[model samples]
Target: MTTGTARTVKVLVADDHPVVLDGVTLALQRTSWLDVVGYARTGRDAIAAAARLQPDIVLLDLRMPDMLGPETTAGLLAGTPSLKVILFTAYPDHAAVEAALAAGAHGVVVKDVERADLVDAIRKVVNGERGVTAGIETDAGAVTARHGLGGRGITRREYDILRRVAMGQTNPEIADALGLTRNTVKTYLQRLMEKLGARNRVEALARAHELGLL
Candidate 1:
């Protein structure tokens, strides 16, 4: 499934399970725009293959030998700043997923996600969209505690807006991207700033980074 031009998207898939690796690779290979360049069974191997292959995107499993999704995501991004990562998990562990997101994962998708949704998510993420989660329920309390947020915790909406702000998106752009009114975006931004004890967008992002919520 593709739109517009015929540009090919090189992809590297990393999964410990051979069955899963093969299934995902074959499925993605069926898509005209996606090229499955390589596969890895461990986080370290994924990192190595990503560096060697230089794929545009990495479909990484949430649990792998040597390292978890968040750690691997951080390592991959540190090595290849231009690579997009999508965390693929059988279980929707909110804390872990939030950590991966904070570590700069482009999106998270359940293992059972529909092919169409997965394709859409990759496309959206490649288009610079953040917080692309599919078939996973986010727990605000779990994410708050994971990042050491006490007494005050941000809601899902606030977190979404915060990520967009960190990406340097304007309020109007955020509103359009999230399908929300500008006033609603403003309200969420205000609440996020208060929760982070920041006076402005820049300060809020700084505080969020200090708190490990970004």
Candidate 2:
């Protein structure tokens, strides 16, 4: 929550899909602590609305017309540094989610998330906690238990690199995308492979799939 007095958390919902936009707006409006302030169909519209409405949080869709969630998140944060963003997506792609988080999103929730879970996540984020998937583990211990990684869990950065590898991106491309040097990317890749007990990228990806990391 922002400093000062306690008050309703104003939210702006942005989604290209009309059904989802309306449904989410209505659902959020039912919460006494949250007020749905506005709606937007495109990322540009979202940015404009956030500026005009000065909402406390923006429930942004992952894939919007004109801009992606992470880009929109960056724009919103640049304009209003105090505003929080929670990404709403049907596809929880590890790379995309990590990219959005890196862009300053407070949390990521799946589209099919239960109303209670969504509300809890929103409240948690507003209360200064990192939001996570509804039924997924966000901590290292839980991740290790779920993935059976022998007490070693894959990190966000490693998962990002792993996802890129699964997408068939070259190391240089991954480095450029992540703003890392080629050598740094190589080092991270090597470390991730070792964690996965794989000899190369192909084997690493296979191991990741077996562990449901990909």
Q: TM-score: which candidate is best?
A: 1
> What are the per-residue Cα lDDT tens digits for candidate 2 across 115-211?
8788887888788877455544473234434443334566667766776687678999999988999999999999999998999988997987776
In candidate 2, which residue ranges exceed 4 Å CA deviation?
A: 1-6, 135-214
Best by lDDT: 1
Clashes (backbone N, CA, C under 3 Å), per candidate, total: 0, 0
- Measured with C-alpha atoms, the lDDT of residue 213 in candidate 1 is 55
Listed in order, each prediction's TM-score against the native is 0.64, 0.63
- What are the Cα lDDT values of the candidates? 0.80, 0.78
